[model samples]
Target: MKKKPTITAQTKQNLIDAFWELYCAKRIEKITIKEITTRAGYNRSTFYEYFTDVYDVLEQMENTLISKLKELPMQQLSSPGDPFPFEALVSMYSHHSKYLVVLLGDHGDPAFQGKVKASMKPMIKEILVSQGAKDGFELDYTLEYALSAMIGILSYWFNQEKGPSIENLMELITELSSEGVMRKLIG
Candidate 1:
């Protein structure tokens, strides 16, 4: 007999959730399979059934997030004269704030952010190129700056206990991206 997909997914999620709780409190190096299994109310063997080790759990979580991000209608947002899709961006961040807040935080893996930026680079480059950005160093720098700024803003916002509302966050990013920070600050 085969196990139901829902049950398997739920089991995996329980393990991931347990690992995430511990991950948020300390570095991954400090986490252990024993602890995760204990917290998840499962035996050691069951943890192995779903994950080879602690790091696997984190990797799976990152992969899931990136995969979901790739599913967004990013191409539509790249059309000329269309504002950057701040609403979609904000909604995605808000929906995943719980995981992202920690994944991009002090205790999280530094390489995760690099992975995220790499995944986003192509679409962002497409958008920039559509807006008349030329290839080479300028485009490279602009891509890095844009990805860094957006991630930085999200990290800061999600870390806040009472972060701005979604609409406000989207508006703030729009103004800063469109008008430039210096203009927003000076005027």
Candidate 2:
């Protein structure tokens, strides 16, 4: 009798790590399953046992990140007079900066960013409404602006070698977010 393929969490993580490494080194189109398995120290059968293709692996990675972000204490930021929950936010990104840098790099996936925005918008909207933003065009504009600026700042931080300290980054986010860019510009 033939043995069934046993997929373990370790093996899946190895594959993900290996895939990220290869993806960092080259474009996704240039990466092959053979390379992924070889780097992961697994064979073809083992690689296929968990993921159907490279895109599937990428999607899984993106979903895993999204899930982590969703689990953060977003409700804490909703209250009035609360300090900006910067530590929690920055730590989560810095901890996973390796995979994130790759995704936000020159060869990054725009689709992944889109998915991230979609997943995060609702939480941000709730936070804003709780902080007294009215449900109107202003709310929509604020959501759009906040999400875009966040993605841009994160991408910059991940890519730069001497980016601001996490605390500084948090301060920058808080200041700019509270003080509108136009206000700073017009001053």
Candidate 3:
């Protein structure tokens, strides 16, 4: 996204480091490009050379963080069932809670959230299909409800920094799925 050659490894690292420090301490709105540059020891022009805004910096931070967080599939997730997905999502959030709270704080943009949800949706569909779910279940309300619940739990847990452990979360997910998620679509 950088149009200028002014971007450098050191500059990128400085900006990320500055953003992380600010995000961890408080909400994203309280932080500013000026503060980031000040902390990173870079000026306005230097900051512009890399990211467009504080939000952009956070966006990139999140993109990078999610990629890193998703690297561990099983260790990072509860079972794939809807009810317990939150636990797995929450554990990953806990792994990167500071980054997430700031990235998704009140000041966070909705488009980024959409991007995140879009990425996860197909995976859910795939899980459903693989489990012998009929085509009807792919867009069924139960799936949607389950997804929303999981996302909600993830948001709450990340923001509050409180919730069940990953193991418990997985158990909950399996229990919820057994209730209906594993049922035949043809039935």
Candidate 4:
């Protein structure tokens, strides 16, 4: 029989879940380790064994999200008409709605937000470059514009109590990316 690992998987998940619950209610700086452990029903020793501090918990969470995003088939998202990739993105974000609201909202970590944008930059560039090639326009400015707009939109959507449905948000993004402001303004 395999030796049982200490700090079992469920325990780690519970710690993360508890930390998220508390972090959502108040800023990370305002939260205490005691509170986290209390909520998680774990003692300080156990918490210490797994993490260095509240920030470590946040870092762990960020790493998990980054890993998930890295696993996405970004190269497969060749066009705006590709609903599969958009669906996956929206679903992944929606699955972590509460955590996203806390992490991407007003009191969120600026560094983490920057990391999120940086991680997506390459994939965004790839998609936009492909689209721009067909549209016959300079994409340098457009790529930055699209990325900033997306972050703003995502921040807004996550903050809402009952935001637009995932499908609705995805549709709006697809429409905006496909039509663009210049075309809409010209028409």
TM-score against truth, every candidate? 0.86, 0.85, 0.66, 0.77
Candidate 4 residues 85-153, lDDT tens each?
Answer: 566666667787666667777787767766776777667556645544332344435545665677678
How far off is residue 101 in model 3, in Å? Answer: 3.7
Q: What TM-score, to 2 decimals, does candidate 1 have? A: 0.86
**Model 3: per-residue Cα lDDT at residue 55:** 83
Q: Please name the candidate that would achieve the greatest lDDT relative to the true structure.
A: 1
RMSD of every candidate to native, in Å, equals: 3.8, 3.9, 5.1, 4.4
Candidate 2, position 85, lDDT: 44
Give the Cα lDDT of each candidate: 0.78, 0.76, 0.64, 0.71
Clashes of 4: 0
Per-residue CA lDDT of model 1 for 124-176, tens digit only, reads: 66765666656577666666776788888989988888989867887787777
**Model 4, which residues run further than 4 Å from truth?**
1-3, 80-85, 127-141, 161-165, 181-187
Off by over 4 Å in 1: 78-83, 180-187
Tens-digit lDDT track of model 2 for 1-187: 6553464878888998899888888888999999999999999899998899999999999999999988878777544533234566677778888887778667888787778778777876676566665667766665666666787788788788898787788788877865773232222
Off by over 4 Å in 2: 1-7, 81-85, 181-187
Better of 1 and 3 by TM-score: 1
Best by TM-score: 1
Screening candidate 4 with a backbone cut-off below 3 angstroms (N, C-alpha, C), the clashing residue pairs are none
